[model samples]
Target: MKNLCYTLLLLSSISSFAQNDSILNFQDETIYRINILLPGLEIEKDVYKDFSVVGNLGLFPGYYKNNNLFSNSEEGFFFIPFIDLQVRYYTNFNRRIEKGKTIVKNTGNFVALKFTNYFGTATDHRSTESVRIAGMAYDIQRTYWDHWHLNFESGLMANFRC
Candidate 1:
């Protein structure tokens, strides 16, 4: 009788732990941003319970035109790369339900710290110009569509160049 009771206790504990593991599992997402028909890729991975990291890569094609803002004619191509580390403290992690489904709660309000780097070169009618920019920003994302699980972000950024 004593051995049977111990076995049952162990089994119960294991089942409880398994259930909790499912509830706290990590989620991941991949996104693409469209820039005037050019596409950029971004990947986001959950790190901790309420934190995640995102990385992005984008490219812009070069063009030549007359009466350009920088000079009579300018042409250049460039790459933009950025990384963002953010935390989302979900206000309704497990409290919301829709159409008999438990609403995923990671898409909530968030604060983010971001770093961006830009390097490029442009050629004008008279001279060639090279530019490098490094920037940091603090951003906030607010949930706009709770049912559809969408959020928008706004931020201020500062840039430095060498």
Candidate 2:
């Protein structure tokens, strides 16, 4: 009786492990911008078990302000639009496993290559000014406790009139 119970338990555990592994297959995610009160969208798609690509687009509408310090009285409107593309490799995919099951997770340390572009125009209720910028950067992102995330990046950038 004891041997039978032990064998059944072992088999059940193995089946559960297999089920968990199957659930970790490639699943794409689309996220709307919430951290900032801006209109934006982000999409992430897994290309392989450990690699993914992400893209984001955002727009900022115009605002006006009075009682300017630099000028006597300043009132203006500005609009900006930006886009970002990134490639990420998840490091924990190869180093962590549980009960013989590998879990695919977005929370981990990742190295990313990114490109960004921005364009905007400002009007001070008088003259109009415009600008454009483009940049490429190497970035590192780390997620902790499945909730907190941080990112650091460095690269060369240039600005131009538009």
Candidate 3:
């Protein structure tokens, strides 16, 4: 009886000592974001562990020269409405975690394929009113001040008919 009691006690102690803490893993989450440079609103839905679909809406300045059907030598800038969607894969979660960086809110290095459409006309640009752009880009995004998203991206884009 004493031998069995001692064994149980030792096993309990070992189990207690082994229960320390869980290992740190990657962070992925759905987030609502805003772009500072373009002043836009974005929604990112996490569909998988490292993949997300992001939708953005914004306005950009478009310069137009009055050369259309009902214009006469007038040039001005207008706010062009745009929308885009991106399928982003966060690629460097392990590397960022190993390097002791915060990976909260799906912030990390990513490669994304994007499609953007502009549907606003700067004058009477009926032929150019709607534009389709597709691109593949590599991006790195990091959080600052716990809530700021700072991102940099480089990519190749092509404008074509859709």
Among these predictions, the greatest lDDT belongs to 3
Error of 3 at 48 (Å): 1.4
lDDT of 2 at 50: 67
- Winner on TM-score between 2 and 3 is 3
Higher-scoring candidate on TM-score, 1 or 2: 2
* Residue 158 lDDT (model 1): 63
Per-model TM values vs. the true structure: 0.46, 0.52, 0.72
- Tens digits of lDDT, candidate 1, 34-107: 33333455555666655666665665444444575765554444333333333334444344322232323354
lDDT of 2 at 59: 72
- After superposition, the stretches of candidate 3 with alpha carbons farther than 4 Å from their true spots are 1-24, 65-73, 122-128
Q: lDDT at 125 for candidate 3? A: 43
Better model by lDDT: candidate 1 vs candidate 2: 2
List clashing residue pairs in candidate 2: none
Clashing pairs in 3: none
lDDT of 3: 0.80
